[model samples]
Target: MTNLQDRYGRRFEYLRLSITDVCNFKCQYCLPDGYLGDKHQHFLSVDELRRVMHAFAALGTSKIRLTGGEPSVRKEFEQLIEIAANTPGISTVATTTNGYRLAANAHKWRQLGLSQINVSLDSLDPELFRRITGNGRHQKVLDGIEAALDAEYRKVKINVVLMKDLNHQQLPAFLEYVRQRPVDIRFIELMQTGLGKDYFDAHHISGESIKQQLVALGWQVQPRGPQDGPALMLRHPDYAGGIGLIMPYSKDFCASCNRLRVSALGKLHLCLFTECGVELRDLLGNDQHQEMLQQRLLAQLQQKDATHQLHQGLTGVTQHLASIGG
Candidate 1:
């Protein structure tokens, strides 16, 4: 069981697989105009995705996260979940969704061996939520959150993309929400990805500012150990659950990156900010060259960029978050 280790000494044990690039909402920061058209519609079949998971599991991968514009919107999403959860070496299966369909499927997800769930909930206010997602499904999302809680999932988390002058004021409310519920809320620093550069420039808020505010409020921050992803986990003595901050800019978040993203079209993204990738759809299901394909993937993993260059003010990001499965 040789694990996939990168040049920077980060072992890639978690795989973020984008089952589809299509999404229901037009989140201002993710997909401004909804799903990318036909050109981006190419997606991997469920069987192909299963085989890919098997390949990664054989390489010592133990966790697989299903991501997408909205993984719940993908057809036969449960089957995909089951596949990864049942994979030989994979021990955990998780999904990051917009919570549109979570309410209806939360129970099924829990029974399917899904150890964790992360739902994106930026704003609690209905109108503001609609404005942020560009869709009037705020009530549904809230209902989904409630349903997730009702499902009694082992790990339920809410993801908040903190944007300046947008949903930043909701941080306190989020903290309160987590205290009342068993779920944890994570605040992700707004990233400068493709297709949303203008929006990011206008709305990007540093997680550091939010953290300072929390500290000023007398919140005692207790450090938690390694997380499933890149978030910096903190426990507050006053708060019931944990709070996670993913600071990609102020900190060198890429230095400890331990995951790889596979696009819906079967392209491997060693880094979320980079467009460089290795296509693997053609090699799926080919036992004759499976070893060769694994070697090729290992080579690419070894070549992963030491760190994301966005921190240095570099531009030219052409991959949108929706397309990259963030």
Candidate 2:
């Protein structure tokens, strides 16, 4: 099978498949409130997700990362992981979860061949965590992180969405927390997409400044391997773990964007910040010819935006991160 390559010659091998949009947390920037109204109806079943993975695997997709409003909230979470890992061409299967219920399944997830697990933890302080996530499940997330480490997955990463004046002050503490553990800490720049322009303008923090601060704090930072997804990986000599800065706004993270996102409702998002996509669930559900589906997918891949224009402003995008399976 030929690789799925965009017009820019970027081969798309990574697929961020959102299992479900339902979530337990209402993180201010992700989902200010609980699950959005009626959007969960579009979630794909276990079989559907499996079929989607098989199609992508045939098209040379080597890596699959399951995301969601909170992926663990889905009923078929474990089954989906196994499906992705067992896919013919997929080399690794990973998932990003809020960690609210990860402790209960971390061991099982590792047994299912989940290569890596990324848990979102913004602050070390319990109170601050509660404020950030709009819930008091900070301890649960910590327990989940410990469970993943104990399960001995290849890597366990912590995702911190940096927001000005909101958990931003805890950067040093977050670094220290990961230094002692065998986990990678990723600091994500707040993206001005779907969260409303007002909210983004108020809280968005630059990843560049965060990286500079980490350097001043004596962390020997460097770029990670090409395989290390979009995150700008850095390491400190004294720490057991490394630091990753996902600078969505600092630079053109889209030049090498070798990924395609499929939302829970079956929409194929060419780029995270771009609203352009094709409705893929219909084709997959209709039992259309595999070659036909592949051609349609390739067509959309060619239409993928050269680079996300979030820097220009969130003029056209209105869907929240949850709806899009961030």
Candidate 3:
């Protein structure tokens, strides 16, 4: 089997597959206006996703992350997780969600073989969370975390998108919440997407600021696993939980990129901010195209740019994060 290596020699072992673009929450950074696209649009079928997973596994990919506007919103989410968990050569099957359904379904999903989970929890304050996500079920999300822990998940990850004058000042609260929990709180720097130029300018804050705070507070950096996402993991002896900072604007941020993304419609995205994606749905129509599908994926990796052009104020075709399950 061939490895999915790009021109820059970065081996791709992780795939972020979006099951659907339809999200329930109207997060300020992503779909603040809410998902306006057709909710019934044709996303990849379960069989198509199976074929995609097999093709990637054949190419040395061992981790598959199912993402979406919210993956749990899909009717066949459980089936998708089961398929990924049972797929040969796939050792890890993870999913990122808004946690709306996690409180009730965490145990069932865990039993279905989900190995990892990341839930978006931007604010600890219920009202603040409601304002940021346009959802008032903040307590339900917290319960979801507990349910995941009870389900025997080794570690749960909380994704926090830091916004200036928004949830940025609540760092103390977040640190306190994780003091006794085993979850890893990931603070993501607000990114400049295609449609959020003004909002980005108003709210964007550097993750470096958070890192400095962590370092001064006696937190030490931790080594990352081979398939870990782009985050600088750190640990504190006094705290049971960990902290991670995802600073995409930092120097050489893309140098260690080990993952690729596939949109819900089966378009392969080499970079999150790429100008466009290459369609692969036609090749996914049947298992007979497995060889051809792998060839197309390998060919496209050669064309991936060494890095994204976000610093140059270009977001490409990504009008918003939800469009590709950011």
Candidate 4:
């Protein structure tokens, strides 16, 4: 099949899939406390997730990212990654995790053909970190990072969600830590949604701020490949790999958007800001829907929006980040 392009002239072949809605942490931004799955909440069984994966892979998706509130928290997470990685035409298979259990599970993931790991590490400050997550175990996350390095995983990227008047003071320290490690660390701007808007300011610290500070520290900010999305992919002059800034809310990458999302319960969302979706859950009734499902997915991509504009009124931004496949 030809590379599917949107009306904006960009291809739509990458997908981020949320395998489950379950998560272990109560991170104020992603999943605040006092939240519980009510009677209406639905989760995709492993087989159902694979069916969607097969359908999309057949439609020319080469890269699949496994995400969840924490995908690693799922019981058959490794098997899911293995299936996606081994799928025909799949060039890359990766996952995003909070890293609490990484130390023990990185090898398991690696053995299953996982390509890259994007782990969330908000702060090195244990107390502040605990407050942010509403859970302890900062050391566990740190250990998981080290274990990924020790296991010689192909690439390890640390995702830091930047919040003002909170952990902004620790940015320099975070950079210093990445400078010594082989990993690529990215500073992601706090997104606007749910508890995030109430907990964080709309202002996002730019890649320029990070570049300037790196220069002050005597490190040259060298650019990296592709240069898509929120990450201002850059390498350091003396450091081994690089540092990245994914300032989405501060610097939107709406025009070059090259991805789609499949929610945990078989809903396909075209944009992060769009509220409605193309429900594939009904297709679960029969294998006859596979071909039609592929067509529906393509039709949805044809109408993909150029930008999220999430900062604007979120009257339609209903799905939680986890449910929407972050």
Q: Which residue pairs does candidate 1 place in steric collision?
A: none
Ranking by TM-score: 3, 2, 1, 4
- Can you give the TM-score per candidate against the true fold? 0.94, 0.95, 0.98, 0.91
* TM accuracy, model 1: 0.94
Per-residue alpha-carbon lDDT of candidate 2 for residues 54-91, written as tens digits (9 for 90 to 100): 88888888999999878987778888888888888888
lDDT of 1: 0.82
Find the candidate with the highest TM-score and give its number.
3
Q: What lDDT is obtained when candidate 3 is compared to the true structure?
A: 0.92
Model 1, 130-166: lDDT tens digits are 8989988888888888887888877889999999999
CA-lDDT, candidates in order: 0.82, 0.82, 0.92, 0.76
Model 4 scores a TM of: 0.91
After superposition, the stretches of candidate 4 with alpha carbons farther than 4 Å from their true spots are 202-208, 215-228, 250-252
When 1 and 2 are scored with TM-score, the better candidate is 2
> Candidate 3 at 50: error in angstroms?
1.1
Candidate 3 error regions (>4 Å): none
Tens-place lDDT digits, model 3, residues 1-326: 33999888888999999999999999999999898998567999999999999999999999899999889889999999999999999988999999999999999999898988999999999999999999999999999999998997756899999999999999999999899999999999999998899999999999999999989999999887766667999999999999999999999899889889999999999999999999999999899999999999999999999989989999999999888978
lDDT per residue (tens digit) for residues 192-257 in model 4 = 665465555543455567667766877654443352444666666667767787656555466557
lDDT of 2: 0.82
Residue 136 lDDT, candidate 2, scale 0-100: 96
What lDDT score goes with residue 94 in model 2? 91
* Model 1: per-residue Cα lDDT at residue 227: 40
